[model samples]
Target: MAEVILFYFLMAFILIAALIAVETTDLLSAVICVGAIGFGCALFFLFLRAPDIAITQIVVEVLALVILIRVTISRNATFVTGDREFFASVVSVVILMMIFLMAVQVLNSLPAFGDAVFAEVTDSASKTYISQGMEKTGAANIVSAVILDFRAYDTLGEATVLFTSVIGAAVILRKRPRKLPEEPQI
Candidate 1:
């Protein structure tokens, strides 16, 4: 009971922070919102008893914060942006509201949720896993079993792309044509 209440509270906090993330004029404040939103969401997931997802969310949030801070610190105009029109902002809010309402409706329609869901989803997955898990992967880690067994190639490809992007970014960022004389430090 208390957890459900906390979940709603955290969900509200996440939505507010995410909205502020998009609306804030200051880059630093916006970045703060992005991290706050991510942490709030991770808490919400934990409240729902999904610790693994919560951990992933927290790790990704930290990575994003580090990257954003590095980029913003290197530029004075990181937060500068052309002003959005009044009509455009209004339209954006309306569309967001419609999407929220639809999501709420869909969520409300789901009969299986909360504690009752765990036993059911797990039972079903376990059955499938027992039947075909070896085909998915020969190993015994249920989580990794599901991921690697079921989606090994997909995971491998994603890792390859991530590695490629990191190497490419490092190469680009490290390139320098020539060295310049140091000026007086202000």
Candidate 2:
């Protein structure tokens, strides 16, 4: 019951933040609202018992927010003209509301927090991991065994992608040295 309440509260907070982000004219304010929405999503991941996902969400959100804020700070303000902007905002809001409704319905169909789910499958990979992970991998921790031994390539791929993305963002955001014009020859 408490979890459900918290989830609803977070959902409301995220929705409000999204609305503010879309409606605000100020770029900084809009960025801040978007950050709020990202953090709210991180909280949702935490509630879903996915700490790894929550941590990743937080890191990505912070990086994205920093990049967005920096871009907004470096760029000149441009006045938005015409009804097209308003129409686009309306369309975005409608889509967001539809997604929210669908998510709520899906959440309603899921089991409550801490509920036990009994799987009838006897020859599952998880079962094998639980039974023989430590013996095969020689790691004391099951998670370490699975990640380091069984899923090492997958983890390496994820790390490579993250590193590449960070480097790309850095390259894109870095300020280039201004070129000085040569003096006219005598």
Candidate 3:
């Protein structure tokens, strides 16, 4: 009962933060609101007993907030969008809301928390993974084994892309070397 109340509260907080983030004209405020949304989501994950997800969310949110703060500090501009941008934003929000509603409806139809679910087929992908994951990947934790071994190439590619972007950003932000005045011709 308490968990349900907390969940609803967090959901409301996330929705409010998202709305504020989208509607705000100030870039910094919007970024802060986004961070709030991220924090709320992290809390929600924590409430759901997913400490790993919560930690990941918090780390990602902090990094994103830092990057956004740096960008906003480097430039001074109000985030005033024209009609087209506003229209596009509104359309995207509407689509997102529709998706959220559909997901909620589907979740409502599914089994409740702590409820037993009986399936006709006992042999599923999850069962196969649980039985063979450690053997195949040589990792005790199935999740880690799957991500670090089975999807290693994909993870490496993503890491490489992130590293490249970070390097590019560093190069762009570096102070330019001032040109020395040419010595007077002898």
lDDT of each: 0.81, 0.85, 0.85
Error of 2 at 35 (Å): 0.7
Write model 1 residue lDDT over 20-82, tens digit each, in one string: 988887888889898898899888878776777889999989999999888777677866676
The alpha-carbon lDDT assigned to residue 2 of candidate 3 equals 86
Sort all candidates by TM-score, best to worst. 1, 3, 2
Best by TM-score: 1
lDDT of each residue in 1-186, candidate 3, tens digit only: 988888889999999999999888888899999999999999999998777789999999999999889878758575656446788979988999999999999999878864535443488666666689988988888767766887789889999999999999888888986689999999
Question: C-alpha displacement of 44 in model 3, angstroms?
Answer: 1.9
Q: Which stretches of candidate 3 lie above 4 Å from their native place? A: 79-122, 131-140, 167-186
Better-scoring candidate (TM-score), 1 or 3: 1
Candidate 3 minimal-lDDT segment of 10 residues: 112-121
Candidate 1: C-alpha lDDT: 0.81
Q: What CA RMSD would you report for each candidate? A: 7.8, 5.8, 5.6
What global local distance difference test value does model 3 have?
0.85
- Model 2: which ten-residue window has the lowest total lDDT? 112-121
Q: Residue 26 error for model 3, in Å? A: 1.6
